[model samples]
Target: MMELDPAATFRQEAADLLDSLETVLLDLGQTPADRDLIDAAFRALHTIKGSGAMFGFDRVAAFTHDFETAFDLIRKGKIDANHDIVTVSLSARDYIRALIEAPDATDPIIGEAIVEELQRLIGRGDAKGAAGAAAPPAAAAGASLASGQGGWRITLAFEEQILRNGANPLALLDDLRELGPCTVLPDLARLPALADLDPESCLIGWTVTLAADCPREAIEDVFMFVRDEMRLAIAPLAEGVPDVRPGFTLDMAEAAAEPAAPRPEALSAETASHPLPGKAAPAPAGAELNRRAEDKGSTVRVQAERLDELMDRVGELVIAQARLSQLAHSGTDLAIKAIAEEIERLASGLRDSTMGVRMVPMGSLFGRFRRLVHDLSRDLGKPVDFVTVGEDTEMDKTMIERLADPLVHLIRNAIDHGIESREARASTSKSATGRIELSARYVGAQVLVTVQDDGAGLDTARIRAKAEEQGLVQPGATLSEQEIHQFLFHPGFSTARTISALSGRGVGMDVVKRTIEAMRGAIDLTTIPGHGSSVTLRLPLTLAIIDGLLIRVGEGRYIIPLSAVEECIELTAADEARSRGRSFLSVRGELVPFLRLRELFDAQGAADPHQKVIVTAIGGTRIGLVVDQIIGSHQTVIKSLSKLHADVTMFSGATILGDGTAALILDVAQLVSLGQGRADDRTPEAA
Candidate 1:
């Protein structure tokens, strides 16, 4: 029987709480007068303090106690919530995160320095929230009409894996008791026999009736980290709420005794599938979404590894369905074909559902950047007005996690190098404050995220000169502005005269480019010299699976992401021969560059007499891919290549076909880059 470490749970919770703190501080940084934001920041710090104490993180508790008290002073109007105060607060928040992350390794000197800095910012005696101090706003205005202590009933049933997730139900219980007088009754019916018991799994539930003056959110904060890993409900302890006394209090001696069965308000009526003992009737077929929303508070947190496992199973099922479809097509029986079609449809729906589960809002990732912008603007002596749009746009959670580092680098570079200095902005007649906009939107099957900076755009001449100096480009070589900008992504590429802590290290932009491309995404830059620069990243909504156009290129078969495919056209041998020196096809008054995968891969077979050109668009540029046969569309379950084929950028990944043969999924973005020479030789493609 392995007991879960409570310290680990506190660390995870601290991480989440710190994120919340950062968000609130960023909000306050923007609107210091917003009392709601002030309160939010206070609450986040309070949670970290209390929960940290419960799990034996005394250092964290002590640090946050002061931090919370400072915010408490702000809440009471004893101290002003100005920009300098917020700046110091944000720094203290980062220090607390460090303490929580590495309790022993963290330098206490740093924490003390931050505390002193905060005190100095708010003045000597203004940072305290002592009892003799001024009363809070609610009580200050003589609106202190006291009411009966609210009696609330809360039911919490933790998932079995809660213990393994580093959560401490006992610590959560401790947090609840500290809120007010409370009675906790354990539900141990789920406890298995000794032989069958898994010590790492949580088998206990609790029904607590608490009488407290704190807000309901404070009570919910007990299980903040485990909120999505448990079933919890809070309703007023009204009449008929079983086993809930009007004002429950626990005697020290009888605290361990089991209380009677107590339940909250009847599961909201919408929770048709109740977790507790109460019977719930099923809803109609169309009520799933409503029911889901109702049960939003009762989510079971799943491990990322578990989602990956399920994805693997779904991929297998899709592969089996593909085989079934092939078998059905070879047979004459209509019923078999129909069954195959039904399975295909089911597999498609399942894939969508799985992907949706993995799709989290982009704002979850973007929120952290607000603080980055705030800090960079201040440090660089530049004023920045940060804005975001389409934040509700969602993408694969995995992609979001991997995208954060690259985005941080890109953003830092933008602020450090792309944006001009304050004096320079004034000289240009632009506003003293520059603006940076981060936006995400869905375009067809891809998500377009743009990081646009209203700063001095790319200095193409400087970039070209740097390239020439580094021997990266031929001497006296002429390069387009776009090509010169592309050189910034080359390894160890930089035009900065001096290196600093942030940019000029010649590491970030290249890493950003590599990261985006590694996700089978494209990065494009558009800049107006002196006006600003905007970098747009086009990425697939999901990486696990895709609808791909299966094609044969000579002896090899490959896949073109169907989202990139516009339409297909016949490229007769006559046209190929007549257009010998040409590398493009004229269609509808547009010159579209085309690539031959057979030539690209050097596959051993002759080109078909009438080869097919699949028109594809990436980063708004339409290109044609020449292949032999257009087999059809497929639900491609992407299986990444082995380390042996790691350098093969042309193929994003390989997937198992219906015939059990492997076909590589084409990296259209990379292919487009590969065909850049053709674009240079022929008429440029419309971007």
Candidate 2:
């Protein structure tokens, strides 16, 4: 029942189609003989051109026609999918996007340049020559016949209140004609005599036969504007059916004169099963066939926001069930307990289903990087091969969408700065073509995504010198190589001797860090001077709900994401008494620093006789958090805190308990860094 803006829908679909086309083209640039990729790219362009024309984007449709023709040649093996051809087509794809977004822009010169480039790539000297040479007379003649394939036969009847919608049925009929070839037959049976006719009321209806190869989707798209106030039946016509004739008659009285016999196909399944094979089975009944056809024809293409909304509702149901289970557990009745158990099971299953809806393969995110690497290599004049692994791993769609920009920035940096030149690589006994591997894997409850390059790695000495010169670190400070590498994320920090358009200005890595942190994720860097460098990003699988280990800090209850908690140990009186101050804990012969939540939060209550230590790890560092009581695990629905407390680094966000009490969600990375003395030494007021 919800209405969507037709223009906005067209734009969204256009962007997706362009993205897919770009990806396939980039792949073909590397593997020119790939027929599947060639066909896929062509299909995407063909669909975009067709849909653009259907939606009144004539300029875009016209511009894309040439590129589509070139790809068509590639599809038919007339011309190979060479790198030069792919590059030119990729540029054309961007031009098509520009045309779709702004057809009226004053940029004739830009269009001319793109067309010239396309002509060169296709081995034609000019657009006129290419158009004349490629255009076939036979194909021109087949156009109208191809467009006249059977499509929707719409029978529309409107009520008297149709005028209230400020719509004219005749205008609606005119609009349908623009979609394809249409023959409209007016139903004069509903029209009144001239003396009795009300000029304002819509008494006449129409039955139209449209011939279009466009799917039922485009047919329904035509009626989107007047769907509510009209009675409409859209059925596919038989092959080669002629246009509807004018002045068609409906003889209702003659049909009422004779008793109709039941169709043999209408017999029950039990009766049909006993039919003799030699007699031939009766044709399917019309009503039964219609039902089956409708079942096959109906489909839905939902926008992602709708799925997110549904997931949120499912999350709410989960929390409500949690509350019910708590109340039922406190009651004495067995019936209440049984019902609560059933509710818990059902809610859990529903949660999984909702999460599944949000799950999308990493391939969708990985596909775009091929194009990124291609463009960056071209810009930098470097030869690089971008390899991806674990693209089949699935993650939340929201996470994947947000990951794109950051990933692009990282890939650009890798191609421009991380990889060495072909001469430099050959001198170092490395391959002429540099390699960058983008891989992902599931670690515990988080997704570990890594971008690695086989080139000259980070220069620790240069980085340290840069850090000191920029006043990012204390003068004469003794820091590890890893600490020096972290300086790459500082704002306006770049070690490049020469600035280039692709990178060098050093504005992107900082943004990547901020974006990842905002998602409650962390980014880490690992490098070997001549081997290569790898940047790994660890992120939670979902943002909405999480498994949390609840604990009490002073009078406030906080949750530590269960994914980060390795194990909990009870600190005995002897161990607690022996260890004091900023450091303590010797677990499995490894010294781990411990922080007491009571002391950290300035609690007034005395420490419990028995304290619990929750061991947690971030990256490679392990630390322990001393808490009063381990309140066990919970399914937490994350609710962000207000702007007033947004700067609080200790708490990532907050959530509401079933009892209407608030519990802060602990930031494990911040806590681990604090316990390891990695938090900023300067006070907030000082900064």
Candidate 3:
């Protein structure tokens, strides 16, 4: 078993806190007067600071001290949320990440500069108050937190797993201190003997006494995250009693679930921790520890390399299982065939379990973009309302990470070029604010992500003129709007006259195209003049294995992603004669375009008396792929092609068959996009 690293745990917890901090900060910009959002931001900072100090992130802890104070002031109604506060706070959020990642390399001056700006913003608020001016809008509207308590008190007993949730109890305790003069007594009555103790659990609870100068909400905010997990009660302190002290013992079973990062609702909706199965009840002080101990096994952090290694092993097992299946079918041994079937079932279950482990929600990628949009709107002076849909869609972890840079480029392009200026939009009777939407959804075996904008659409005339000037098109070229837009993906192709911070060096779209293609994905462009434009990307759900429909084209065998296959039908001699002049298939009253793989690949061979067509759906269009034979279904383990075959758009990747022969996997999206309905059989289409 690998040893648990406390430092690594601290870093991961700190990262989660930072993500939560960012979410709250961005939310404050939209609803600046939201005191709950403000306090939420403060709590995130306090937790990061406390955890940092405990885990030896001194720079992070020290920097967060002043940062927490700024938010604390907002919570206390001492300051109001304004553009300057939110902007500087966002910058501080990024800086805190830098401090966490590389403290030694990060310039301390940046942090000092941000803190100075924050101070100036706070000072200006103080200035108005000193002049006896009217309170800020929020405070005037009574949106700010109450200043004085109504003799209220709170008793909080957090679940034992609070520490696991990446929340530092000490941080909450420290925040309570900020409320007013308060005394905290730690309760260790529920603490088991040291031998049976879990360091990650919050074994000790706390009782507190405080002056009635602070509101009850302020105290409750301290235990907000663990509120559902633990017991919390409040009441007014007795008139004669200086403080309320209640002694309570926690039920061991009640706090069974650890308060890990999942309860925060931020941190990419971090998963919750469930008690490990088969865990023996609390052992006495002297009992021997279990060597197979697994703590709160609902979630475990394993290195990416380890997962990759495990996947490689699974792939080999699948191949071996395939060989067994092939042998079982060839031989006439019922018992051997049954064994192979059982092995197949076990292998399939293991594959699914392994894949699920690597699946993460698309929300993790979408959450980081909110800050990007916020910052871009401010910088570009473009009042764009950014929205996201289908954020909960699950995707492979590897694909999710690689998707970030390309998506950033597309989203930036949408704002910088696809969307019009506020004035431009207003002139066209459009709303002052343009809308940029990012969405993702599962389409068959692939995920479709779209970045769309409601602004001035692509200027095809302008694109054509630029293409002509650059000698990319002939002088009298009559290219379609899409053909003109394709020029945008050419290297160094930009129409902007000035280069700004966000874009306009003509170097982004080409990179976006190449990056998406490298992942065996395809991108689409659609636009309507004076209306809007959208870019849709189609990507495979996983890179490892998939169920494929295997077919033979001449002497070559190819696999099609089974998710896209609707059905297989015979291509009779009469249908072939009819399609000889036109590659069209009549499927359930729909005229679908068809492609003959044998002819398309120039595979020299005699025509088979019998041919089959695999009806596949891409996007919403049905396309037929004619093959010589249907080889049934296959457990395809995808293997990426070499650089030599990378430019070939017809095939996404290749895989090893049961007979140890290589079979290429067809690129269904690309084929469908390139297939033109009512077009000539030999004339290939381009997208």
The top-ranked prediction according to lDDT is: 1
Candidate 2 lDDT score relative to the true structure: 0.74
Q: lDDT tens digits, residues 564-613, model 1? A: 88999998766575456566777666777788778777888577877898
C-alpha lDDT values of all predictions: 0.77, 0.74, 0.75
lDDT string for model 2 (367-402, tens) is 878877888788777899889999988889989988
Which pairs clash inside model 2? none
For model 1 the local lDDT of residue 254 reads 29
Off by over 4 Å in 2: 3-6, 33-39, 72-81, 104-106, 123-299, 678-687
Tens-place lDDT per residue, model 3, 492-557, is 889987898878788889888877866767778899888899999888888788889988888888
Q: Lowest-scoring 10 consecutive residues by lDDT in candidate 3?
A: 283-292
256 Cα displacement, candidate 3 (Å) = 30
Best of the two (2, 3) by lDDT: 3
* Top TM-score prediction, candidate number: 1
Model 1: lDDT to the true structure: 0.77
Evaluation by lDDT, superior candidate among 1 and 3: 1
Which residue runs does candidate 1 get wrong by more than 4 Å?
1-5, 125-298, 333-335, 475-478, 620-622, 678-687
Query: Which pairs of residues collide in model 3?
Result: 161-259, 164-260, 165-259, 165-260, 165-261
